[model samples]
Target: MSFLVMDDGEYSFIWETLCDLQLIFHPKYSREGKIDHKELLGLNIKKVSVMLDRNLLSSLLKLTRDGYLKDEQEMRIIALLMTWMIMNNYPASAGLALKEYATKINDLIEPKRELREFNNIFDYYPSMMWLRLAEGAIDSIPVCPLPTEPFITEIKYNEDDDHLLMHIAEMLHVVYLCRRRELSPVEKMLDFLIWNYKYLLICESTLVYTAMLFTSQSGIKAPKNSGSNDIGKILVGCRNQAWDLNYLSNWSSFHYYEKTMDEIFMFATNDILLKRIFINTYTSGGVGALIEAVFSKSDSQKIFEVVNFNQRNRIKPDFGADPKIYLHQLIEQEKHRVMETISDRGNFNYH
Candidate 1:
């Protein structure tokens, strides 16, 4: 077979053009009245298709104003959306939430849902890798224009994400439409930012840490070990990169946090405890006391992971508890855990 390659710049333009075209012909998501097909049908349909994208764009803009985390249920959805939006430089992707940018604001929104049990959330949304925001991902915002491509990237109208995106977008629209008159841009944006939920840095850590807190002593890849180190690196790297100018600038509705890195350490330590407990319990205990033991050992990570991520093994789609949850939870949990631990060490001045 012959190999043909499309250049990055060329493919990007082509992809953008395709999406633009889809806005007209397919009209994937036209706003309330930007386009009346009846008006266009009387004339040439193809020629007037250019206006289709504008309507879709308007609709998305309006949707972003809505409250993502209305409650616990909405919090789960909001977390997933944050993960998806931030996984890529979604802010730059017209009419969509800037994942990394929104993440910072989401991060700032305290009392947020703890992702410690993200593994459990994974049961519903499989790719926990994208949701667990690393300190680096948030810190890296100043250096926007992500150096790497998105981890879980997808176009708006692709086969797998088409329905999901549309549904969520519509739901958000309904939310915004309700408060349209009362709230202005600044108010809506702030509301979206402070959408309060718990933040779980522990249970979200990787597998190596899964072995950390459970044992009396640390091990090969303990929170302070080799594997956890890599996890920390990725978390911080991703968070930092998210804020980098290479991705979105300060004005991109995505925050470029140049200040403190405090959360890094906090998230790391907690993630380690959570991962260890969840993996131990999610494996054999299969929703039993062992799960509580893991939680007991974890303190709050277990509960955070379960309630926020797993929804307490309530994830639908029947993926069943197995090695993936073990690995994914451990890996992601390890990610934040490592960063937090290393960050804590970095702040160590007394030693």
Candidate 2:
């Protein structure tokens, strides 16, 4: 089936419709934002089409119509917009527009995939894309041998190549939260601490032990049948070597970590599936709450002490000396002291 190029009017209508729908469904504007639907419908589209990316959009649509791209690829391209909506915390009102847009777009190429399948693709595509990209990153590392002269020349001369590389890096950054979500609760908390507190010399066993102690004191039931020793051993085996702090200290970094955490907390609290998992797993208000509860100021101080003490008195792991035991003892002593204080308060009479 031949598909004609979308006219300027058509392009403007699509662009304006998307923009209005996005505003209508955006978190800050959803309640108060209003659009004159009839007025918008009656407006001249040609005037507004001048600023839109007409060539790029038309090329993409043309590619789909001409069967240069597979059905799934076309769906994924459409789903990228929905993925953007999800990532930006857009409200559900915008999803209806997105789904309808997807349907209409698919119809242009004689839809082979069902609407339900489209919905499913949209729902999980971000996570799947993240997983695939992560795997690709891992596999593609230790960059294959290339014709170095041409590679250097291409990088030096091609502006488009720079743009492509920057785009890939941005994709990796955007999907980071999805990668973190794949981790277990303890691992997630550990990752959070390591990321936010780079000064802390964290190890897997220390984190696992801390989590266990935190769970014990917080009265939160730990995951059934998952022992600290086993988890710690598994994690420690996979741990990377310590970072070169000197280099990291010199580099300027963005404050995106907190924003990422906020997004995770929002998703955990708002999304039904994520909410269920968050509730069942952490039994806390949200990601930040869980991290704060698990790694309190006192806990942080104690961890530093234990870690530093262990570092000073380094013992080979093969020798039956486990630093986690020291951490466990410290937490138990603190718990005992707290209980004694509670008992003392209980016996005191109030005026």
User: Compared with the true structure, what per-residue lDDT tens digits does model 1 show for residues 1-351?
Assistant: 112233555335433432332221211122211223344334432221121111222222222333222233323333333342333222212212233333445432221112112212323332233232211122111111211223232332112122222222222222332224465433332232222112111121121222232322343121112332344334333333222211111121121221232110000001223323323323433333432443344543443454454454332333236534433443344344434544655642111
**What does the lDDT read for residue 214 in candidate 1?**
30
The global Cα lDDT (0 to 1) of model 1 is 0.28
lDDT of each: 0.28, 0.29
Question: Candidate 2, residues 1-351: lDDT per residue as tens digits?
Answer: 112233455435434543443322111112112323344334333111111111223323433334233444333333333333343333222212222233335332222222222233334333334222222321111211212121111111211122222222222221231233355544444443443233223333223323543344443222222222232221222111011111111110111242333221111011122222223233323333433555667654554555466567654332126444443443344334323433444542211
Q: Determine which window of 10 residues in candidate 1 has minimal summed lDDT.
A: 261-270
Q: Which stretches of candidate 1 lie over 4 Å from their true place?
A: 1-197, 200-220, 224-279, 291-351
TM-score of every model versus the real structure: 0.17, 0.20
Error of 1 at 2 (Å): 21
